[model samples]
Target: MSAAFDYHLVLQSASKLDHALELVWSDGKTSTFHYLWLRDNCPTTLHPDTKERTFDLLSVSADIEPLSFSVDNDRLMIEWSEGDHHSQFSGEWLREHAYAGDLRPANKPRARSWDAQFLKDMGSASFNDLTTDDAALYSWMKQLDQDGIILVKDMPATEQALDDVAHRIDYQRQTNFGVTFEVRSEPNPINLAYTALALPLHTDLPNQETPPGYQFLHCLANDTQGGESVFADGLRVLEDMREQAPEHFELLATVAIPFRFHDETHDIQHHHPMINLDHQGNIVELKYNAHIASVFDLPEAVMHDYYLAYRDLMGRMRQAKYRMQYRLKAGEMVVFDNRRVLHGRTEFEPTGHRHLRGCYVDRTEFQSRLRVLARQHD
Candidate 1:
């Protein structure tokens, strides 16, 4: 049965307009369907084999009219006066495409933020279970979307194992750092992660033209002291700033900052607001990186205000109420949304081998995998 045939979603009565059908749904809400839309979307016009719209709209006259209309149990049936054509539209279908000014569909998942206390355990999965079980993988992807992070234990402790898991979701996003880079203490480090330093909470690769949306880090060995993983929701912090200090939130939301990554081979630079907003003024991206940030080129007065907002945001990120810290174990991997949440590590002693393999995948591919898996499992 079509979704429109649901008895609960039926329309009580329809008032046919000169150019549209004014519908009063059983639930009290109302909507209108244009005369042209009904003529073009009749079920009889749909190909029987393909069930796709086969009617040619150009064949219909611009001043089309319906000879008569009637409310059936399942649909609003229409008879065109221009021709012996017919149309039947379900009430559910009309509600789905109602032009009621909603920004997005009701079914799409909205990103919700959480602090440390809000989490139980990091969404955990065994490598073996996720690799073979489609249902398990679907759950993992949902967890990733909701939490923006997941931890998988019991990996095979091999390079191929990490690659296998990554490809199952998406392809490798190779950069100057190569397909996959090793994160061990180096004498001459090109990046801060290459050394045993307490990296601050920040987004990854903020200097890229389009920074990596999601990052994966697999702990191969971890016998050193410190180096606990840190996670924080930058958008949640921005929400706090909006309520606590509107001025600070406004400055950060509108001010663009420069981030750069320079090396012998690659010189990547990008300018983005610390808090990015969409047309609806919703936080779409939280691009921040103290490590890669370049000097502000704004006027002295503007820079002063920028720093004040910047420092306050930085301080809020460090607050215990916003952070979630967990130690990574060997054969354990963590995945996170690099654009939404900030990730970092505490300084370790550089004693023993503390190796971590890392890689990146475009968010588009990640979302594609999730949707595919969801359909398959459903």
Candidate 2:
């Protein structure tokens, strides 16, 4: 047997500095080529990183000049005057750069900073000074969409005010943990007696098949001594995990874990990868609720390893470096992206009173409101 191949030059064009080449097949099909791609992917002393695949052409400046090109028999070569370099393209090179697959869709745009319409909708003062107004509320929602959290101050210290806040955000009062759930210090022998419940840092409704995306808690009364609400940005924790324990991060991103909520009233369970990623595999959300984790059904050999990774992740969650704590005063409400932020509370004295009306809102609704408000400016 013999290794066999056929070669021919189909089309060729050149510029003063850059060139274009096209190759045709026996069936008369054509494929275009750019000299810049060849130069960038050149396997020579000038281009040491052969493995570097550059797909994002948007990053290149418009001022870049094209390189000159030529075809000799089966090989396509490019010559650039900038560095006085030459690159030869092989059949493998053309195949590697060929557009044989579907192009991926563009990434969803994320604002690096709040826009003018967003600020106007949120009210200018609210964006700059956190002032309250109809526009300010709109801006607050935009901020929440961008940062996954927003604080509204000077809200009315009444149940009606809490409901008003919920209504403004278009949040339906979730019945399971409805619009207003009293958070008074209760006596429970099994947990603690006559003391505030030190709620663990976790997202609400982890057991639900479709967990709520946003949570808003308005402080109506806070004459209590302690019970400060702690907020941890789950995305920040994920970044820390990437830097400190990459393997653990990989495990969380790849392994699906079971979460459950079972009681006399309801029994719910679901499985999700601990680190959720967008279509591009970019870290988007982290769901870690040990209390609700029903089981870690890993292979017997890796069971111990899984537990160790879980423990390490929990330790990182507890670190002060990853958490931000602030106590809400009367008439203030804090809303956060429940899917990407963990909330907890410190224990307070039962003698004093602490009350908050909490509610959940779908994140899509919040984002929809923002998009609508953004369009109003246009």
Candidate 3:
């Protein structure tokens, strides 16, 4: 059989339970669709143009069940118990989205942790291809989403290059610094990034309620004596900590620390653990900025231990094994997940000129564009 015909799902049988409908596929796989779920996702429940959900769950009874259900080759027909309504779900759709056994909807790309070795085979793309081709853009986004960092080369040494690539994904995320920021030695600078000083590996704006996501830094010039860019996968370091030092990892993930960024005009403050984890204990974010990290106000009993944990993680990040040190060339732009990739710089000579322009795109926007491109490719 042809691939498309062979891949098509044909319902072998469908049995209605009290509150759910069970389906048996031709390939012997099964799926259980809850009545409420089926009702909420009915074709009629969504706007034809916008595809937004219009059905309200509260409008139906909680105990609603299917009155009758039947299989028609590749589709499942259902007569709901409420409102004399019916729902038709294609067997192909039901199978692809089956929420039974090992069948589940596809999840967003997961982080692929990396270390110094990543630099040897770093993910990179050409700027011209990304801006001109959808396939190239999708491939680049996938790599970026997986690796949390990438390099885009062949860019013009101009601010427009950075802005064009950023808008290709979505609108730029504006912070207090503005929609875009400059990175060069400046007198009376408000941020250390604007001064000629060595920066520690840290995330930007950990003080904000939601820090900027993906950061794109375009190197306009790099004629300075030093100023090599340094980056480390925060997730990689944390993963090792989880295995080698579980207690220290627990402390960092559990203890919330205060972070503040203030000037004459603005004061932004928020409390987040150095290592933020999901409910399943997966490391989702790392917020470590020694410059802006407020004084620890933990209980006197745990203060000593917290410092030890914090110091251990910071020391690991500085180690050469976890860091990728490179001198970015002009016309090269580096993109990184600001939340998961710790970035820093070596101090440069104030006499020599080094310039870089940067902007941000929220992770949501990046993921949304990726998803749309993925659908088109699929």
Candidate 4:
């Protein structure tokens, strides 16, 4: 049958459980909804005036039983014996929360690993109309989701342009340094980024409770030599480590290492596993910083194992097969995921001058903007 005419949505079967109900749809999809879930989500559970749930689940017995169930008028109706309450559920909601036997949400894409091959495969777009054009913004945001980084060309070198671009999807996330900051080779700098040195690939602000989601670097001038921007996919490195040494990967993922940044003015500290995982045990975030990583409080034997895993992870990060190198010119900016992609630079000689303006944006706002754009287009 043709796709449009192949529509089939009907209750094929209904079964009751001790505390739940299972329904099979005509499409051969089965969904199980708990009794408590049905009671909490019932339309009448809400206060008519306040529009908030008036039903107190705690007042209901845990052994609440459904007296009868029937599929009528394209809805599944269940009548509970207690309080004589009836619930009519739309099949659409049941399909959405279907437990595909996985603990995590099914739609979320697991992290994809990439390496030096990504250098040629990275996406790029124009900075000229990103703020004004919805299509342009959506395209760039999708690129960031797919590749974890994207380069924009021909932007105005003004700080306003940087702010405009960052604000295109979301407002700037302010830090102790400020909403935005500058990077340059200067005297008595607070961070090593202020000086000319080869910085190993690392995430930014790992010392914070929750690090900023994204980092934007806008190059205003690049008259200096040898300061090439470098990137490495931490997800790729973790995949290789898990394949070569599963035990080391487990150590990095389970051991909570403390990171700190302290000076005369500020002292920031955060403890997080270098390799973070989600409920489904998928790599979600990578936290690493060689500069500010604090001493281990772990026992001597455990510390030895952690050091081996730590040093091995760093060595793998430096492998040529997993690194991407790109040098930004004037009027160019690159935005990257600070959590998943490790970024750094090769040491540069200060022949004349080089400068870049940078800022941070939370991931929530960035993804929200893209979803809104998608809905509008749909």
Candidate 3 has its poorest 10 consecutive residues by lDDT at 1-10
Tens-place lDDT digits, model 4, residues 84-190: 78888776555545563212135456345689888887878888768788888888788797778888888987879899899888899998889999987643445
- The lDDT for every candidate, in the order shown, is 0.80, 0.65, 0.86, 0.82
- TM-score, every prediction: 0.82, 0.64, 0.89, 0.90
Give one digit per residue, the lDDT tens place, for model 3 in 1-378.
Answer: 223324755788889766788887787767788888888888789889999998888898998887888898788888878888888987766766676643554444388999998887778889999999999999989889889999999998777999999999999999999999998764345664556678889999999988999999999888877899999999999999999999999999888889999999999999878888776567888888999998778988889999999989978998999999889999899999999999999887666667889999999999999999988874
Model 4 earns a TM-score of 0.90
Per-residue lDDT tens digits of candidate 1, residues 1-378? 234333576667778776887877776666777888778767677899999988888888988977888887747877888877777787667666665322113443367778877458568898998888879888988888887888888998898888888887879898888999998763345565556668899998888777887788999988878878889987788888889998998998888788999989988888877787776677767888888898778767789888998999989998999998888999999988888889988888666568889998888898889888877786
* Winner by TM-score: 4
User: 283 in model 2: Cα distance from truth in Å?
Assistant: 2.1
Superposed Cα deviation of residue 58, candidate 4 (Å): 2.2
Clashes of 1: 0
Model 1, position 159: C-alpha lDDT score: 88
Error of 4 at 139 (Å): 2.0
Per-residue CA lDDT of candidate 2, range 149-192, in tens?
Answer: 77766776667765666666676647465546766543333345
Candidate 2 whole-model C-alpha lDDT, 0 to 1: 0.65
Clashing pairs in 4: none
Residue runs of model 3 more than 4 Å from their true location after superposition: 1-9, 16-18, 105-109, 186-196, 278-282, 298-305
Clashing pairs in 1: none
